[model samples]
Target: MLAQLTNVSLSFPDKKVLQDVSFTVYPGDRISLVGPNGAGKTSLFKILTGRLNPDAGAVSRAGGVRIGHLEQDLSDSASGHELTCMEAALEPFAGLIRLEKRLEEIAVKLGREGHASVLMEELGEAQRRFEDSGGYSFRARTEATLTGLGLPESLWDREVSGLSAGQRMRLALARILLEEHDLVLFDEPTNHLDVPAREWLEGHLKNSKVAYMVASHDRRFLDAVSEKVAHLDRANLSLYTGDYTAFRGQVERAEEEGWRRYEKSRKQERKLRRQAQDYRAWSEAGERAKRGAADKGFVSHRAAKVMKRSLVARRRMEEAAENARAEKPFEGDEIKIGFGPSRGRGLIRAEDLTIGYSPERPLAAGISFDLSAGERLAVTGPNGSGKTALLRTVLGEVQPLSGGAGVSPTARVGYFDQDHRLPARDVTALEILRGTGDETLARTVLGRMGVRRETVSKPASRLSSGERAKVLLTRLVLGDNDLLVLDEPTNHLDIETQDVLLGALEGFPGGVLFVSHDRHFVDALATKTLRLGIT
Candidate 1:
């Protein structure tokens, strides 16, 4: 085994995050880690990397095993470094680079001191090490990895500090891929990737020999790369065989079977209870007959015997009822989203719209679309194709460089930003939604969205991405908006929650305009699609 976690248990001050979670990573294993928001997936990853200690249990790994972890944050990766993208990508091969330099120095010495036996032996060994370490082809591999992740050759020569957040994330991923560790742990690696980049990553992971366990919300990506799934829910871990789609099928079947067993138990319990009640009544009648018997010895003795038999039967039935009882199956909280009545038929209109930060250099131009009530429009394109800029322009948050984009005066808009930025770091989710002046209703909505009571009271900054998304969605739910503007709405949502949100959006009376790269989500929800091209 590459690594193993046994009977791991973890908890925070307010909640128990994981309980008795055991998992193992074997050589060439391709596993997908899946769970709801705030389900301790990150904590488990940290534990595997030896960055966090579990409250209880043991973690073991093979001696000298190298593990690579790709985290969500890349703010400190290339910090204080002016290294170019290529330099950063090649950083993992520092040893090989040094070997190459030493080989050149050895060659120089050999030229000066011809026929030196010791020097000749050293050169041969160095060359062999370099070749075995893949020194000769490291550069080629680095370039391919960087390019495959959507970092063009043009950006490779640029300084790492100059790259955008998404670019930097891709660069970090490229570095990890090049490291070629025994096992790799990825946490939402596709958050910044476009469709093509995600596909490339899927192919790379599928063909790689290294073992990996990835936690991602992208259904299509999981289906493409996973061989098995590790699901964390209700503070427990369960393993399912096969890809994500297969895992889902298994879970559904298990739930169905669980409910079936529960119903059968309930039926048995009811039957036993009725039988027990009838036996008790019969025993009581026999006792009364014995008490009122006129024929002395025989009648009283017979009644006494009858009462004892009935009492025994009653006890057996009562015991059977107790043994047959079954508790109801547990169900997690679900997101309940519904828009208020819409007032406008025409929600948004964009005509030949040119959008960008500066008029001289527009990201995209000549875009036109009309969004009406009850319609859902999806915006799709590669990264940097102005999908977000178009959404902002339609919402009047940014000025259009040319042409026009307008929202109806009667339209009440609710927006879900891709970053999920709350009003303030210190503000609690409850405080944010209490603006509606219905605290009870606000709490209800938050609970329905799977935001626990304790979680709702915590500061927004402490909430996980999924929790924050649900909180923002709760705010939207409490509003009376006629149009919803969602950016990457499914970014951090689990598959089950995504399905709930999809159903809610489908039932919504208002119009929806969203920018997303999730193929499954777009395919299910989009009534009209606008494809933007790079400028």
Candidate 2:
């Protein structure tokens, strides 16, 4: 086994994150870890990587196993602040890098006609080690990986700190792939990847010998790359030997069977309860008779014995009923999102609109679209294709470089930014939701979105990414606008929450416009699509 966790358990003071979770990862195992927003998938990854210790049980790993963890955070201190993109990508092969530099230095020395027999021998040994370590074409491998991950040669000389989050994530992924560890851990690795990049990564991983465990919400990625699905639900890790679709089917079947058995148990318990109640009534009547007959020279021994036996039987039946496990059926909660009444049609209209930061360099131009009342328009394109700029222009957050993009005078647009920049980080979720002027409604919306009651009072910035998403969505739902503009609405949400959001979007009466790369989400909600091209 590459790594194994046996009967692990972890809990905080207020919540039990994981309980008795066990799973084993073997060499070349491609496992996808899936769960709800607040499930302990990340915690499990930490445990596997030895970042956190389990409260109970043990984690074992094969000796000398090398693990590469691609975390969500791209600001890696180990890569150093001054390193260029190429240098950082090749950080794992520092030995080879040094060898290459030394060989160059020896070449310069030999060119000077110096008597350097020892230097020549040293150079020969370094060359042997370099060849043995697959260093003969390491630069080619690095370039190939970077290109495959969508980071081209033009980005190689740039400072790592200068790259955007998406670029940084790609570069980090490229670095990890080039490093070629025995096992790799990826947490939402597809978050910033475009469709092409995701496809490339899937193909690369499929052909690789490296074992990888990925925690991802992208169903397509999971289905494409996973050979096994590790579902983390209710603090238990259940392994299903198939892709995500197959695992989903298995879960559905199991849930149905569980409910069926639970119902059967409940029926048995009801029967026992009825019998117990009858015996209790008989015992009570016997007691009354015994008391009444006390003055009539005493009760019969048979009657007394019958009364005692009846009481004992009733007690046993009650015990059996209490011991039976008849859990309630599982009915998931859903967020209630209803847009307010629409004032008029043509909520948003863009005519030959050119949107960008500057007039000289428009990201896209000659774009025309109209969104009517109750219509859903999806804006899709590769990264940096003016999708977000178009949304901002329609929202009047940015001025159009040319042409015109206008919203109806009567329509009220509620915009959800992809970054989820809250108005104030210090404010609690309840406070933010209450910004809409209804505390009870705010709490209800939050609850329906699966935000815990206790967490509502915590600072919005302090919540998990998913919880923060729910908070933003709650605010949007409560806004009661005639038009809703959402940007990557499902970025951090789990599948269940995504489904709820999708249903809300479909049912919403107001006009909708969204910018997203999630094909599934777009397919489910978009009535019309606008495909933008790169400038």
Candidate 3:
């Protein structure tokens, strides 16, 4: 094993986050850590990366093993903030580049008559070091990695600090790969990647010789990239030597066994109950025989003693049956979610409109199109291709095509954006909801989405990300909206919550136009998809 975690336990004050969880990372372990929100997936990664200490247990690594982690981690502070993706990736070899330049400077200085020969010889040694480290070819390798991740050549020179979240994340991955550590840990590596870019990343990871562990809910991604799947369930961890599909099959089988055992136990308990009833009948018969003897004037001590002993025996049998019944188990299947009332108008019509930040790159031009209501369209294309821009345009937050756009006037819209910037941060949840008019009605709506009364009183900033999402979605639910435009809305939500949202949306009456890279979610929700691209 390249790394081993043994009997690890971690806690926060009164809460035990992880207990006796252990797993191994071998030389070729391409594992995915998957679980619902609050499952300690991120916390586990922090411990593995040494940012946090476990309350108990020890972690050991093979001698001389080198590990590299992706750029998204909070603990990874680099000295190249001023550099671009290409430059940042090549910064590790900056020392060699400096040495190369110094060697040249020394050579030039040595050309003077007074320069020492010893200095010139030292320059030769420096040159050798630079050459051996591939000093001259580092830039090419860095550019290649960036390009493979879908970062355009033009972006190679842009300041990293000026890049968007997606671009920055892509750069981070490039830096990790260029570092060439023996093991690489990717924490939510697909956060900002588009579908194709994500695919490219999977290809690179699969081809890499370095070992890695990726924590993600993307089943297709895990299947595409990993040879081993490490599952986190019920606070227990287990590893399977196969792709995600196979591992999922294994889990299903285990759950099936649980179901069978549960049923068997239930049946046994029922049988014991029946046996106890029969024993009661037998005891009553003994009493009846004693009563009959007494009525006939034959009530002897021996008869009475025999009746009492038989009753005692019956009671013992009943106790045994009760014990067996106590061992019976009660288990229920995972909840099944289904939506009602799926029928709706067939189109979300938009009139002639132009959309863009500048005329040079209008997201959509004279965009006259209509999506059948309930049609699931995926607005896609390269970075800055305007998928999100189109979403904003439809939501009326941004300028539309010169002629303007329309949503059939009667079409109500439900918008879910990544930033959730629709509301102010300082306002209490109740105030925001009441902004729709009717404070009492707002509270009733918030409750359905899992937001409590106290949370409604707190400012939006005080609420958790999930809670914030709940608030926005709750508003959408309460409103009589007919069109839902979500902008990477699934970014921070757990799979189960996503499924919950999916359940609510599956048969929703309105049209859904959301931007996302979650294939499973799209598959589950999108009845028809729209692809965005340049004409």
Name the top TM-score candidate. 1
Clashing pairs in 2: none
Model 3 clash tally, residue pairs: 11
**Residue 357 Cα positional deviation in candidate 2, in Å, after optimal superposition:** 1.9
Off by over 4 Å in 2: 75-77, 99-132, 288-299, 329-331, 334-340, 424-427, 435-441, 448-450, 459-466
Off by over 4 Å in 1: 75-80, 106-125, 333-340, 419-428, 434-444, 459-466
Q: Best lDDT goes to which candidate?
A: 1
The digit string of per-residue lDDT tens for model 2 on 160-250 reads 8888778888887888788858999999888888777788889988999999998988888889999999988778788999988899999
Q: What is the C-alpha lDDT of each candidate?
A: 0.88, 0.85, 0.72
Measured with C-alpha atoms, the lDDT of residue 451 in candidate 3 is: 59
Q: Ten-residue segment with the worst summed lDDT in candidate 3?
A: 330-339
- TM-score (all chains, Cα) for each model: 0.92, 0.89, 0.82
Order the candidates by lDDT, highest first: 1, 2, 3
Q: For each candidate in turn, give its C-alpha RMSD to the true structure in angstroms.
A: 2.7, 3.2, 4.7
Task: Return the TM-score for candidate 2, rounded to 2 decimals.
Answer: 0.89
Worst 10 contiguous positions by lDDT, candidate 1: 332-341
Comparing 1 with 2 on lDDT, the higher-scoring candidate is 1
